[model samples]
Target: MTSAIGEPNAIAITFFLVFIVLSLGITVWASRKTRTAEHFYTAGKSVTAFQNGLALAGDYMSAASFLGIAGLVALSGFDGLIYSIGWLVGWPIVMFLIAEPLRNLGRYTFADVLAARLRQTPIRIAAAIGSLAVIAFYLIAQMVGAGNLIRLLFGLPYEAAVVIVGAVMLAYVLFGGMIATTWVQIIKAVLLLGGATLLALMVLSRFDFNPLALFAQASDMYGASVLSPGRQVSDPIDAVSLGLALMLGTAGLPHILMRFYTVPDARTARTSVGYATAFIGFFYLLTFVLGFGAMVLIGRDAITGIDAGGNMAAPLLAEAVGGTPFLGFISAVAFATILAVVAGLTLSGAATLSHDLWVSVVRGAKADQREQLVVARAATVLLAAVSILLGIAFKGQNVAYMVGLAFAIAASANFPALVLSIFWKRLTTAGAQSSMIVGTVSALLLIYLSPTIQVDILHNSGAWFPLRNPGIVSIPLSFVVAIGVSLLWPVASEARRFAELERQLHLGVESADELT
Candidate 1:
């Protein structure tokens, strides 16, 4: 399955170009409809629940889910299922606790929800910081996936592949905004799910259409240990930490939270989550089969020889089952997956900068629609550049592993503040700010000291942080700080507004002006 030395794959290249051209066409069409800040950030709040569900699923089932998790399963066996389970469980938390309230209270970003009942200035600043950090880390994982995928499939240099992805993503967000990004995600989602389903069925047909038989074959080939838990999460503490990050982090993802605003009302927001959870859960099931299929059909030696991180397993598996044209289709789907997810991330980051920071803070919510739109586009370009550099800098890391770091930050920083703001009264602006700042800083600092960085990347002999993920410690610390600060420094005004916030949360926003 190895590509020739520095030679482009003609089939893959043709498929990739076709996808690019089609996506750009969609973007051009969307740009014509994108004139207002509402349109730019939330697609005019006009997306139906079904379309938004597909879009949300598209955003969640990213390169990390499609390529990284499949590769992890191929490499680590049963331990890789942990990532899938962790991510899937978080949707219920979003559906029940966050999604409806988020849509009703906030207009553009999560900070809007927080600022609904609290002081705007400090809250927006802290939230923007937390959000941008999460987006940055998540963006790195996606960009890394894109770089490796393009390099392997198209024979481009890794840096060049990264640049191409960044440039294209920038165009989507800069012009078409959420309208374009949403449709791109929808298209990518359908293609990815179909490609994965087809690939999984092809593998299962060889094993009598019974998934257990595929697992059995994998067990026989790699030994029974491959069907059981292995060393990837050998330490109890690390297992708990990673679990907390993956499960809770999904509720905190800025781009995901932003999706609720694209839908019309609170009820639609909840419905969309229901649809998304179903799609995502099914997709994850297919990945389990796809992973084992790769291990049994392609063998570990061939899989690892192609890419040490095992990121190429799914595409390689596609080729094994269906040959070169199938490989081209699956590879293009992977590229589309990367592009759509990064576009969503970039748009969310732009919203935080333009709506939360620029319009709300810098101008004291005085900026016109035109100015806000300009700032958002400018921020998109900035984030795209930063993401491109980050992708090149962290060239060879396993993207799934990189995403875990992002989840840790999200769980620690964004999740706690958001929950406290919506569910806990007596949460002062000071309390929310402190929680976000502490959660973000502690998670990042611990990550730097963890083995993933101190040893793996820095070449140090030992890591100061014992666990690979800081979620076990950082998540609780964030909650504790938030509770302590609220209890000790209560704000009567914020507490009073909780009653009004509650009314809006359940009853929905009454006026059109409220949404704007």
Candidate 2:
């Protein structure tokens, strides 16, 4: 997929530098406006619904979506489309179940909503840990993708590329916080959609603007099996498990959930979700065109000859169809995708670290905005270092698979507690904490025992856990653990407030905001 591996594409590298310079320019502009913790965390809650929608879509569609899914579809056909379907299906659930209530309830972070009535310290600790776990896995995945893609496009060293990504993301989050991050995401989203539109058009024009013709050509070249489900999800249980994680995980992603608070009100939050759903769903559909186009137009042998993972398919397709100039544009868009996503993830980690753990938990909410802002930037730097190290360590791994694991963990650790705390009258502080702890531990343990970590990473043939995804087990267990623990010893104070929380969940800011 990467024909110019050792040979640097000067045009692509030039465009890459251009995008980086422009993005850093955004950071500088945003820093002028970023002042308090509110600005740092939620962009002063000034983002309009449509803008936040674009930012949400941008932050959500990372290198994993653009490159990883396209490559998967290029290589595995119908099986790769499953990832797109699963990823997009989650948006509606997030809109109906999470967006409005989450925005109204949480001022900055989702942990605020989860810990609203519960004991702040315990809930914050548990929620912080859960948020951090998701961010850690996701950051590494994006960083790994960044490293590989940069090396492929620019001929840069993998470790150096990862560090460059880390450093740039840190600068964005540290100085401009959510404001810079949001603009970066919005810009990236626009560029990605635009670039993908052009690429898809170029691919479709070759087949007389007929998708079926493209598929027919692909079938002629690859065979009928290429249009059918393949080895990626041979196990029905694994498929269901993965679907569960993707559908539920959107409710839990810290960065995505945090976007809700970027808007002004619950109604705006709802509006943002609608816009985001449309944009994200549209983007997912275009990926099919890009993926199938790569297969039929670029050919499998050429793709695999360059990068066996097929990650180079889209960029290579750009080069084949549009020459080095278009290749440069697409490469820049992919890099922008990685930069925007990693910056969003890093910001979420900072919010979780500083706002939830440091201010709310450690300082008992007495820490001022200035102090919190300081901590947030410090945390961003710390997270950046961690991301670089992990990205280097996880080089050559499948970015798509790593993202799937991240979704599973998010679905398990954060989704259940957030849902129950909002809707269940019987939910107690102990229940939420225990559920998060058990969900996180069980998910990590299952992954370590599963083929993903054991056989894939450790090269051990005998993995204790058969399925690569632990969501089907871990998600339900989280709900059960919460229920069981709450029933065993309910926190009457927290349980009693469920009536008000429930009222707020249904109403707009009047009820929900006042409940806090």
Candidate 3:
């Protein structure tokens, strides 16, 4: 059954095989020094700013960004540009506001920042749950995307593709930990950017090196009447919801924030973010070319017949221009992208579970470094299994939609707490906990009842919820809840402790030996 799917080109298979081997080798080498919990969780605080920056890019540019944005632009024109813009704009907020502060306060996870001066148990447990939810949804989306891409490119059975991805990603996290994961991300980022650049050049060369000619050609191909700025958006509210989810959502992601902890200090963290922003912005601009290339070169009818979910736009374009070789290379790159992303998600989830939940909550601040490392590895395996099951369950769904939901949830539950904790002096732990709970619950409830899920998944004629994403509503609700609660219970002692921690985090002073 696995072999019955179309066979990938021999060159493509070889390239993919080599990537897998290289990634695994890096993981094995990284594991040599994984002797302490700090090493397993934070790479022993040894990762440089530039390397961490690349890793952050690798983590941020998931299959959703690489494939989904291209597909969206191919299908929805100007509406797709909205997604690209939203995603790209969020980084400035992350860099200027969140990055250095998060790095200064956090050692392992986002929870470390939020739970820093708070009572350990409740806040840690809540944060762990939020992190796990965000990671699981993200991992499943990537795994499902991997399976679908393998099926499309190699003609492999879905289960076989998923199992293969699961195995490789598990090996990445289990053996390599943060060090291996970072290097794998850097390698994947380089390959992804290189591939996009080559494809973009090929696409531009088709228009005889004229940028205006490319857009003009795309408009003509799409028909001049539908090429207007707002033509693709059928519903204004849905468009706004989508934008809010992509923009705010990027700032809130746990895996992305965790990358800051890998670097040495606040200055390095800021520099890393600047590099990431420039790289990501450039790649998104390239996506516009690729999307329009598909529209003109491949045509909508051909692409729809070839790809049900539209993820095939970029790969199909590769095949059309460069034939079997480019197709194979693109396929291999897509596979690598999925593997790197899932590994990062698994590692983030594991850290939240082990460091935040088990070590902080269950062990009651008494567990040694060795004991914590063991817990983290165990949690990694458990999260991997959970993600595999989810991948299988949501097999044929659009990967972009699932990823969007994860982003929405992350933005709602985590973003407010993180922002307020750093900037607002009166933010109590109770406020933080309430914000997480409210944001998470509201977003999940809204999503479950949304038209996309309620009507589409449940086969209902009417939707209980109107919005496809809850970020616009739920994110604000979380902020309000946190502020309201904090105002009511603004204790002076907690405020003083929080202020001191903020000063320490901003100053980069190391006080607690227990902290990494």
Candidate 4:
């Protein structure tokens, strides 16, 4: 079947080939140094703040942000701004609450931080499950997005596209480790931001460089009612719930948090986050322009008739603005964006399974670096396979919806434990464990019983779980469970140890050589 945008342009294909080669070369070069598990997992804790910041942007701005947000804005006007605000607002929480403590406490994963003041095995197991669940959901979403984009741009079969993405992403994580993945994200971020800026400028230029007029025109195009803040829909409850998930979810994400570990110290971690916030905020503001650009310039009828997935809006707008060559460039950029994100997710998942679960939990402190890297590589391949299968099974579903589900789970399961582990003095092993379990299980069960799963997955239309996202209910539930469980089973020994570790995590810094 031919793509709605016509055959993939040769320029786009050529650009894609060049990217694939460059990414592969970087992976090969980085793999040589990935002899130790520390190098493989955290890039030897050597990445600078600025470099890590750009890479963080690359990891954070997945296909959902790049393609999904623009499409949502083009489709729903102010409703799309909700996603932008949700995503952008979460960074402040990371910068102030989570960043320094996370950097100070953890060695490899978020599990490292939470389990620092708790038992190693059970906490590691629970956190690993949460991390893996979130990672798997995220990976599936990226894989599905990649397949759809490939089909849209190049007229490839869905299976073939999934295979290609899987192979490339696997190579990236297996050979490159954090170093290769970090560079890939950096390059992709630069291109994505550059392309978005260009597109935003072109869009603004179309209205003679007037921002107000552009919005006014967009309001007219989408309808004057849409311009009103509360005019789009009657139900703000679900909107609020979804927003909570996206906003808090960003800080809780394993991949985003893992980026901080690669940097040198808490100060650099904070600096990197600041830079990421600025970069991401600027980019999201441009998304508002680009979204409105599509609404007014491309028109609703033209885009609605295309794929309903909404991933194609940016590429389609590029074609409308700059002809085939520019469209090709945007398409190639989108493809590279998916590859970079998948690499990050896969690496994080592999680290959790290999380092936290296997070496740290199963093997204890006795396992050597060489043994851990081997387990990490094996886990990487396994994760890639599962994601590819899920992607193929769930093709053509809404990318944003799946990604939102992942966020909901992350916010519910990971956020509570992480926040409490760092700040609350009364937090015990029982509290952290119960919170993780309740949050993870409750969110998953809620999703399983949701309308999407019942109607779409089970082919039963009558089932209704009114809340599309579980964040509203499950987040509070997690906190409650943690606190309640802690009171019921108080551990004075655990509490004292937690206080001491908290002090060290907040103030103590080992020598640079002590890290490795």
Candidate 5:
């Protein structure tokens, strides 16, 4: 069956091109001011709390949240809400535990935080590996989503779609750096929120602005079971594992963590998260209405007929209620969503490569601002090319598993090392390094053995691993390893270093000038 959107749609093309042009304009304007390493990496720490807040919302709310959740809820009813709740709950974890200290202690990348109290070279390497892994997996998901989405919406070939996205994303990050990326995210967020609000309002108007009435109508068509938990999450243990990954992963995501540096200080960082939480939570609520609206207005048969994954439900609903123009608008919004996210991911990856690996490791942290900026741009180009290739290579595969794997890795590897470094003064260099390595390796190994890859992807009859996501085991195991290793291998001098770092985290660093 061919998708309804699997043809050349002129309206969709126009909307998408307009977005690309506008973003490029912003990148050009930003490039002029992107002179120093700080400007290139953290927008010179010049962005206001409100702007960073919108950018944070744009970074966190991906195409998955916009189209995936709406489709999931449209298809699976109450069970679909699980994904939304899992993602939303993670923000509080970020707000309370991560945002301030991260803003205060780090200059550009999250590795700076870990390097504060631990051995610089080894800690940076470990942290860089974890950051790159998360970025790679997350980038794959965004790239694949972009290729497939653009193919369906604009009738572009999959390869061409990916290259286009990569090229534009490179232009944003490679030249304009964080400044351009942040504004791109801010614009996309506003468009997305506005589009979703309009879509939800149109959906609710059909039932006189009553969500329950829409639910009743959907239940009448699909039966009462649609109003209850369904097959979206059948396994109790797998559900818990997935929940753990989603809850903890947000605090560890490099792109999300990188946003804190774009703000001025720790207090503004907290404000950004608060605003981000409000925006994200409200958007998810609108997503609920959009889901039920699709179920009732468009019907399951129609949605599934267009796209078997039900991903077309939101776009189809837009077309059904508001005709082709609105569908074009929503489709363009979805594409913009992918572009915004990948830009942030690409920037994070570049930071790990340039700031952490090149400047800090190879150059012994002696590289000047000019050389560092050059390496950063070069790294951005490299990552962009890699992303385009990966998207084209994984064209028809089920890359959904990669998204979950990314979250699991973030939870296991990055989150453990970060929390321990910040709070546990006794945590030795060996303990931190071991925890990150073990966490990263264990999560990857378990997922490879799990039913997700073994039976589902590889078509094996049975599997050694029981759960789909590794978070249930990997997260706790990481913490245990960190604590146990710290106890056994005590480092006296490291404890004193933590005292100094803790003071800086509590007070403030003042500016990027004070970082070095």
Candidate 6:
């Protein structure tokens, strides 16, 4: 499965290039249709319900979910299912609580929703900061993953792989905008599902098409413990921390939230989540088949030798079952998976800077469509540069946990603000601002003091914060702060405004202009 020293994988390279070229072509086509802030940020709000659902699934299911979770399953066995379950739980909550209100109230970003009822200035600033921070962490992790996966798949150097990812993703966002980004996600999701499905069938055919037989074989080879729990996480507190993060994180993810705006209305937004939930839940189940298949068929030694973290389990499984050709196809799908996700993240970050910060804050209501478009493109360039740099800086890092850190931050910072804005009425502008700022700062601070940082980065014997995931404490802490601030320092006018937001939330009434 390993390549000769520094040699290129021509099969993988050819497939990778083909996917990139095709995605760029889609970008060119989308660029012709892209105009105004609406087109750039929300794809002109014209995406159909089912299409937006597929795009949502594509955007939400990153390389971490595809490669990292399967690798985790291959490595930790039953404990890996915890990660899958935790991630899937968040979608139901999104479908029920957040998606509809977000679509009804917001035009572009989550900031649109929050700033709908509150004072625009502080809400925009706080939300913009939270969005950028989430995007920074999430984007860097995906870019780092892009570097590693490409290096392994196509034999590119880490820097070159990262740069290629950065350059291409920037094009998708800069020119084609949300239109190009949404299509790229849909294409990648289909390829990933197809590749995963075929790989699963190949594995299952070896054992009479019964998944239990595959598990039985894994249990026999690796011991019954592999089919049981408590391997990677034995501590209840730490497990809860990770669970809370995964369960609540999706509702807060800006790129995922931004997808709702691409669809026409609140009803469509809810329908898209229903579709995404089905697609994502099915994909996660397939990962179990793929991961267990890797365990029984490929064996631990070979899988570890390829990747210590087992991130290559899925691709290598394709190689094992269908040989080099299938391996090349699956690897290219992984590359596309990374590219589509980072494009979505970069677009969200650009919106934070251009839509929220530049047009809304700096230029105020007077900002023209042309100026907003120019700033968004400029922000994309700036974000792409930063993403490339961070990707290089964190070379060889475990991208799954890097993504987990992102989820923890999202759960802590963005979730509370968004949920409270929509659900709780007495939330003041100052209260929302403090909750966001506090939640963001607390998550980052606790993460730095956490064992993941203390032992891994700081080389310390003991961590100031014992948990790797901060959500057990941070998520509740954020809700408490937001609610506490709102009740204690009630703004009478904002509370009066709550009746209007309630109308939009319950009746699907369109929100009035943000700046007005």
Best by lDDT: 1
> What lDDT score goes with residue 299 in model 1?
88
In order, candidate lDDTs are: 0.91, 0.88, 0.83, 0.86, 0.90, 0.87
Q: Against the correct fold, how does model 4 do in TM-score? A: 0.96
Model 5 vs. true fold: TM? 0.98
Residue 342 shift from truth in candidate 5, angstroms: 0.6
The reply for model 1, stretches above 4 Å from the true place, is 1-7
Q: Which stretches of candidate 2 lie over 4 Å from their true place?
A: 510-516
Clash-forming residue pairs, model 2 = 1-307
Q: What 10-residue stretch in candidate 2 is worst by lDDT?
A: 507-516
* 145-165 per-residue lDDT for model 3 (tens digits): 998888877878888889888
lDDT of 4 by residue, 216-249 (tens): 9988666785555554334677777887888889
Q: In model 4, which range of ten residues has the least summed lDDT?
A: 225-234
- lDDT order, best first, reads 1, 5, 2, 6, 4, 3
Tell me how many clashing residue pairs each candidate has. Answer: 0, 1, 2, 0, 0, 0
Models 1 onward score TM values of 0.98, 0.97, 0.96, 0.96, 0.98, 0.97
Alpha-carbon deviation at 396 in model 2, angstroms: 2.8
Under the 3 Å rule for N, CA and C atoms, how many clashes does model 4 have?
0
RMSD of 3: 2.4
Model 6 alpha-carbon miss at residue 352, Å: 0.6
User: How far off is residue 339 in model 4, in Å?
Assistant: 0.5
Residues 85-183 of candidate 2: C-alpha lDDT, one tens digit per residue: 999989999987788778767877898987776888899999988999999889888998899888878888998999888888888989988999999
Per-residue alpha-carbon lDDT of model 6 for 1-516, expressed as tens digits? Answer: 453312466677788888888989999999999988789998998899888988998998899999988888998899988898899999999988899888888878898888888999899999888888888889888998989888877777889999999999998999999999999999988888888889999999999999999999999999999888865788789998889999998988999999998987888888889999999999999988988999988887888897888888888888888878888888888989999999999999999898888888888857888888999999999999999999999887878877898898888889999998988889998888988988888989999899888998779999988888888888888888998888888899998898866877666655334323
Clashing pairs in 1: none
Query: Model 5 — which ten-residue stretch has the worst lDDT?
Result: 1-10
Alpha carbon lDDT at 443, candidate 3: 88
